[model samples]
Target: MTEFTLIPASGAAVPAEPFTGRHLIDGLWKDSADGATFDRVSPSHGVLVSRSAKGGEAEVLAAIAAARRAFDAGDWSFSSGKSRSEILNRVADLIDRDRERIARIEVLESGKPIAQARGEIEGAADIWRYAAALARMAHGDSHNNLGPDMLGLVLKEPIGVAAIITPWNFPFLIVSQKLPFALAAGCTAVVKPSEMTPSTTVILFELLEEAGLPAGVANLVLGYGDPVGAVMTTHPDVDMVSFTGSTGVGKRIVAAASGTLKKVSLELGGKNPQVIFPDADLDAAADAIAFGIYFNAGECCNSGSRIIVHEDVAEALTDRIAVLSRKVPFGDPLSDATQVGAIISDEHLGKIDGYVREAQAAGAKVVIGGGVLAVPGLDGRFYAPTVVAGVTPDMAIAREEVFGPVLSVLTFKTEDEAIELANNAAYGLSAGVWSLDVHTCLNFARKVRAGTVWTNTWMDGFAELPFGGVKESGLGRELGRFGIEEYLELKTVQMRVARGRNNWVAG
Candidate 1:
């Protein structure tokens, strides 16, 4: 296989765009009011990629006001579903058309492998199309027999302006998870993408505008979480907030939204488990579980960090996982051959390494790779795929969300013990189960407290699956019909067929 330690941006295979400090608001691209900016560097090489607008409270307010105005004007909120479908289709077409440019921007900032980045871009396109279909299929319930004298109709109405704050790890894909659904429900939105990776979202606005999306239907404000995210979450005009990030931040958003009692949908962190029964295909289970955690450098909130194997097969599965872990190529994100790329940044890389070291100090054994890997001629933030064994559920590495390429292997003596250990974490986002027996897989998955379960599979998600979590993992859901429901409110219309006014209240 061809290999290279580092390649200059000039020689990068992907096409480059003119990255700038512009955030779209009210259908116009403008500099932040204070003219301040933040540098966005490629995590692959720690080199400056572009300067982005560091929007603050002033911009946040402007965007919210714009969204509120657009909703109140009924420009998009009252449009025919067929018209909305056409617009959404055009938006998807643009995404597919510019997939290469968008994928390149995603890899540069988010540090995802080129192939995965491309996949995310294409996946987002599919989501847009699926959401378009949902727009046309927003069916409401009709009750013709509520009462002989009474007629009732339950209608779903838009929940007004939404504040969409997405995380750095799947910048474009995460936004697609929320934004398109809100639009499908005819809700206008003011979005705040992670400052670390705002290029793709900013570019997305250009496409939405080209798709004939009305001015202020969707707005993007780029900035850090504090002044920007905090303000947007609490903004009185914003009727809803859909956030995907840390559970800590998710809590703050809920608190901030309490003032307005706005609807909140949170897709947060997880310490997801991968359970392997003794009767499972150990080899296949090991490889799939390793990929579950290592995909996207293990920045996934649903990373299957807790690999709970039955005692009978724990040693063998752990060994197989170590072998699979080593084969994952960690290098330049632009390299098509690279399966694992750099961490989001230096600070994030340090946090990941710290977690691994702490786990090792607590009596956990480092199976294969446990530290950061170097890329010659460059100080890129790359961490090796790590497999740690002899871990207890009480260990911080097992309980916490590392969001890195580190796996903790724990053993269980019985199915009951495995279930207990898996549910010990404060998170319950998702889980995976592997077993040759269909009954075992189904029963075990049903017992897990997570939102989604994969029997004999891992890290598989589609636009049609309702994805979310219980407990502290998150609130509400995204994707499928449920995603659109989060942006709508139920209204009942009742009328008396007798045409006689009842004076019971007055009497």
Candidate 2:
């Protein structure tokens, strides 16, 4: 394991302005046009951390213009892939070099456990490196079958300016996943990170600049999704829009992008399922399920919110999960021992609580936790890891995305019924199968409607494998060759060899 430097928070007071209150546009930090700013409160202590520039139409327009100029001038696009890859590698190194500081900022801003935050920082850096490798590896092909003198070739070109809108949850990770690939593909980008957790992204923009990305090649706008997000999606100059957020907002973005006919890639919300079988290891399965739903405070788009277990094992699995959920610590995000941290904000916390209340009112059993946890000496948006059994497939708690540390449990007797239950929702982002049989694993992998299915594992991902969803979950892919291709456009060139082809016309 790589030893990471830990920053001590023993100082009496943190800096008044821990982060710069400006938008990163054209490779420079600038304030919002209207001088508008929003306070970013820490979810851990409910205190104001920093005020960030609230970008609106004017700032959005400036970012789009800058990105368009960069792409139209072929500044980044004309550069060699090796050169681009080198710059991206430098970005990864910078992140790794400053991992501790970045992790602290993420924990403070996003209310994730310090350990998890550090891991996220490491993962973000890895994504940059992976994208850097893909930059040099992005190649086209040639095929010949017509005639000796005839030839056909295909080339993948940059898709011009890309508008990268990332969600508050996993801000750094989502940005790393999209921006690096866009830059690697020689495309300029205008980034709009969620205002709630804009600090890490601000740091990322600075790092990208430090890596020597040219002016106008990358930009960041911090603001609400309505105006800033709307502008980015509808911008005439932005040739592509890549977004990761809720399905509702994703639909709006797609609708907005239709006006300009821009390419769109969406990684939307999910109500993913984690199914356990009677023949599986119940102890390991319970631990994995606990982590899957409670990790990142259950704010992940692909969190296993739904647990579908075989009827023979449902009771044992639920009991084990409930017991484990109680053991998982939930407290201050800065605590090293804390496994579950606070939700993004009070509003989200209230929403999650509402779901639990409704489920109980609807006569469901709250086997473990189902209420807010008010920790002493600390005021944070913390919710205990909740497990609600006796949930039906059509219940609101089971169908809707609560986006918190809440789990809905259901039972199935047969493989066909399990598949039907898992595929019941509109989402098809990811699923998990816990079975010892090879045939069972292969069968579930083929039958599950999700984009990624894990056998004996849940929410585990790598850069080598593609990640995305089917059906209402979203479109386009992230990671792997498919992810790199999202930023490229294929062009085919052909040549005719027959000099005597005009004989028919002459006749």
Best model number under TM-score? 1
Question: Which regions in candidate 2 have their CA more than 4 angstroms from the true location?
Answer: 1-18, 497-504
Model 2 scores worst on lDDT over the 10 consecutive residues at 1-10
Candidate 1 local lDDT, 1-507, one digit each (tens):
222233223346433544785888999997989998998888886667778989988898999999999999997998878889899999999999999989988888888888999999999999999999999999678888977788888999899999999999999999999999999999999999998999999889989999999999999999999899998888889999999999998998899899999989999999999888999998789878878888998999988888998989888888888777767777878878878888998898899889889988999998877877776545578787888999988889999999999999999888888888888989999998888999888888889999988988888889998999999999999999898999999999987887787687875
Q: Candidate 2 versus the native: TM-score?
A: 0.96
Evaluate model 2: give its lDDT. 0.87
- Clash number by candidate, in order: 0, 0
Where does model 1 exceed 4 Å of error?
Answer: 1-18, 501-507
RMSD of 2: 3.8
TM-score of every candidate relative to the true structure: 0.96, 0.96
lDDT of 1 at 36: 87
